[model samples]
Target: MTVSPATASAPLARTPLDRRVEPDLRVALCAAICVGLALLWWVRGGWIFPLDDAYITLHNARVLIEGHDPNYGVPALVGASSLIHLSLVTAFSLVLPGEAAAYLVAGIGPVLFLAGLLTLAQRLSLPWPEGIALALAGLASGTGQFLNGLETGLVMAAVTWTLVLALDRPSRLLALICGLLPFLRPELGLLSLILMTRQTWSRLAAGSDRAAALRAVAADAALALAAASPWLLWNLAATGALLPRTMAAKQAFFGHPPGSLPASVVYAAAMTAGGIGPAAAALLFLGRDGPGPALLWFVSLFILGFALTNREVLAHNGYRYTFALLPIALFAVMRLGAARGPSVLRLLILAQWAVALAVAVAAPTEIAAQQERVAQYRAVAHWAQANLPQARLLIHDAGVIATASDLPLTDLVGLKSPDSIADHRRWTAPSNGAERFRALDAIARRSGVTHAIILDDAPDHFWASLADDLRRGGWSLDPIETGSARGPYILYRLAPPTDPAAK
Candidate 1:
């Protein structure tokens, strides 16, 4: 049997990565990393993340903890983009309160991600300095999401370990985990395919057991399908779709075509290029010797998938969708071992790490300030809870408000509300006020919404514009009158149509 060059990177049939280091010490190091990052963000900033989306994830955890159907005050819809994180936080919250549980789970993401990078670096035997820099760069790139209390870190953790297993372990267990990747986040599902392809190919290239490798790949695929079956079936049964609506909602919101490449090309490129860390991660792939081209392939496919799906807004929410690419790039670096490229490559790598570290260090205060701004939104939610306890509320600024109050909610952004969830494409399309008006009006009427609580930046123009067409004359303005925040919002008493004859 002849071994191809591709087999050169294959792991020895032994446990690797810090294998020489004591297990207890490794665990201690991971814990310290998790705790250190958590304090660096939360103690300096605040308990909550700066973004409203974090609270949306938190809300799902709370609902699960309370044993309610996972809905944002409606049935047949799960509000969170990541059910995996939701379930994890819910499980964690059973031992701790929802907020603390969420915080702990969130912190675990970066730690797992860092540990993964270090493990891979050790397995591949990269220089210690480069390994640490690469690991920190990956962590820093996603610091916002890790600290924000969302599933970005979990997604990274999952991807890292999946890669680790695929490259080093290569078993049926890995394939099964890959199968559940989409439920974690849609991008990971794509990664699952790419990884399995590489893994299967690598085994074939080994020339040791062609028949056994083929059988193993088949078994892995079957296990993955088995792992993923429940989610797909449940979604199809409940929502008439095989995939979650969250992706569709976001694509629509950003005016990304659900099926296209031409229109999305520039946007997707901009999204990919927007972050120095993610870009540098891909760059690391260029000047290294590797048996396979997994990272490059995945990144290309990711951008292509984004274009076809029209999911730009890459720079949104701390580049949440793109952050996974950072750790993945580092993983590629580990697989390829240290770069033997020009000195410029090393300097550029160091520069990427420095920028990422600076952003992460400064993020706490910035995030805290942003949360302070959201205080008004929370205040408004509290006001509605106290004053209009029975208000069937239609709300913008969905996240913090949903967590802050129990006033029945119909997310004005259509992320949660049953009436509005599928209407994102219709409303978000490049259309005039009338089209968006009919969309929102239908949601308001369908939900039997008596009042609306819309909070936006300063004048609250975006939400206000969406509500403009409704016959909402003399609606209450600034109902709560809280301190300076992102915005002071309006709670409207949506009037019945002024013209009785006009339907």
Candidate 2:
């Protein structure tokens, strides 16, 4: 057979897949680096419980495993932020002690997150060096939350893989992941919505058959609904609400401040810049034909959502809410660098690795700082547990101390109480602190609360007012001195009013 010139050149015209280099060795090397960093974090600070919020999940898990309502004594309230995460921790707690299971899950989370990033990079078919660098960058970006035991790492991994799969092609797995997202974190469902919308649009734009596109959309919807129905039904039955109480509480507490929208956008843009620097800008502006739209959509939606609802909360906790952007930014860099040349890719990879390495090295210090903040709370919890074992306590930071103390607690912030949320809504004005505290005091008295634990540096004005009210209103304000590194938490002993008519 005669070989034509066109046919010979066709091989060179083949897609990038034909030119793609094997990434297994690079994947292994990246995985090894990630594992080493994870191990360093584990050895240094992984075991220390840094966030009080984590204990709320742990406590709920225990309650569920023991066949009670997940909200401890609050039978009808759905307090946990992530039902799926709580269920997973609950399953682990069944085999191990609750605290141990919580720590173990948190400890293993970063390792899995790192592995997921490398897998994603390999899936994207970047050069091995770039893949390793991206994974390292992801590791560095998430170090704080990975050590703190929040669902941030798990959600980040899930979002990365789901986006990868959905962008590559729509499938039943994508649908299933979409369904499970809300259970992981309610806001994560937004990611699923974005992916689904993008996939549907892509299918239609590609001139695929209408019937096929319809079928794909239908399947995605059905599977997502199936995966999410149980949680949705449970929430409806338990809380008579579509979302958890925690969501409402957060929304109420951190509703968009007037004129802050522009500032919020600036803050989010700044965060994206800090995470990926000029590379992200280059990818967005220069690589418009690539993943720019998707990246831009994700980042913009995330920023707007938080800005309108809880940008301050996002700002707190080391910018964990924005952690998903790290992987997205890395993906953009990979695409941009590959289009540019190997030299550009190498430089980007090196820069990413340096950032990641610095974060990994500083993991211990971050953990220690977090530990110091919670030290006073831990001491107070221990003291309360030992001395006032039967006293029902009113607590502002309701997770760790309440869990550790094993006392009946009225959570003023409402993570574990439905009534507290209702009360907060009734007292939304800035001037209502005195009235709110008075109402809270009444509620506490009705609930038989004999003591209150208040943090000295609590930023909430209502909490500060409550403390002052207790001091002047006949409650004995005794500051318990702890040798803890963090100082000044008060343990107030509630005393009955001197006159019966005063009540």
Candidate 3:
């Protein structure tokens, strides 16, 4: 009676032999190789950020850590591109100096990005081989942007993790991520909105009771709104605007002459396909089921947003805006191959992995190119900090130099200066160089600007007219002697009008 099978505890269910085998070995190997490639690329480049925008965040982080609002040492505006990103960088800066923080952030970005990729691959139920390929594609697609120290990698990780969690089930954590999305990057809010709406609608359609579905939707909405409220309130209070001044300036710059929308969209799509490697071609034919629709919507909306705002800017930014779409594209491709057969999927993965390996091999050249481009600004920043430390300079590319020099800067581009934004808004005409120069001059005088720094190769009409106006206005223009192959940046020194008539 005591030995009765029902009364006796059954032997614990034996763990499946397959389950005991490490599933992540190949994934881990791929991540190590890719991350090593990224680190190698950074080391070759001397661990410098590849973009000037990164320095802007560094500067702001330093400001925040030093017990000031993240601004260019002037009026407190929400000038940092992402408050959350700035906060993280500021935290790192507290532990390390500004430059060291930048490098540390850059190195950490790929790790977070790869972790998110692996999590997504697991959530998608992809086999380890396919997961390796996905990791490769992600590393190849995102390495440059990650190294550049933009919000690209952080946004990528957030977007991938959010999508993975949302696809599994509704949770408060997912809602929280949705709420915090905009603080990562304003455009990323589109992903949050799309995903939340889709999830809520799916629940409503599937639920037996309409009221229950409505409650769930309301809960999700409330969580998202609550999480997002801080940034919204802060921006409103600090800047009297919901969006950053950068958004307004970008809209003003890129929203015009709205080149053929279809053409812009097509061009962006082509560029994205090329950047994501051979796997992107497979995304075109993937079924709408699985992660395809979410990915398609994300990529389509991004391209459409670029078309409406500034396709040229997207193209010029090394196709960085599209890098966020890479993981999704790779996921779609993996899913397509898996649906066909494991063998087919494995072959596709191999092909994509080979492409990624090529990208890794070529990374050194890309790093060199980026280093050369960034060197000019860095050198000029050092020069200005040393020689013209006291000059109140009006600058076009204000991020690197202003941060580096600790200069009192009036950003003619409007990113750091509310007054510059006001001037930009006041002048609605197409970029007339002389008129633009006059507006800048007005802002300069108002800000007590005694010197100016302008990129000689700047495509804006303002650059075209700068030298002429400098001479006519009793400002002497001298090209800064940075031996950069990119070109010379001009530095102008203001002198009191020699001619009484000019005054």
Using lDDT as the measure, the top candidate is: 3
Candidate 3 per-residue lDDT over residues 1-503, each given as its tens digit: 01111101111222354244324554565468567756765766556676678877877776655656332555333466677777777788888777667666666667766777665555445655566566756776665677777777777777767756755656778888989988888888898888887778777988699999899899999999999998888778877887566766754533344357788788767777666667777766546664457667777788788766666556555667766677666666656654665676677667777877777777768877666656776777677778876878877665677566777777776777767766655542255233454555556567877777776655655454656655655555556554434444656676545553452
Lowest lDDT 10-residue stretch of candidate 2: 1-10
TM agreement with the true structure for every prediction: 0.84, 0.82, 0.83
Reference-based lDDT, each prediction: 0.65, 0.65, 0.66
Candidate 2 lDDT at 216 equals 74
Model 2, total clashes: 0
RMSD (CA, Å), candidate 1 to true, equals 4.9
Error of 1 at 145 (Å): 1.6
Clash count list over all predictions = 0, 0, 0
Worst 10 residues of 1 by lDDT: 1-10
lDDT of 3: 0.66
lDDT of 2 at 289: 41
What's the CA error at residue 106 for candidate 2, in Å?
2.4
Residue-wise lDDT of candidate 2 within 1-503, one digit each (tens)? Answer: 11112210011133454334334554565467557756755676545567778777876776676656422376433567777778778889889877667766665566666666666555545555566666767667677777576787777777767646744555788778888887787777777787767766776676658888787778778888998899898878877876676867755433444555788777766765664433455436324543357557766787777766655566556666666666666666666655565676678767766766776687778777667767767787888788877777887776777467667888766677667666656653233343455446555656667878876665655446667765554455555554445554667777756663352
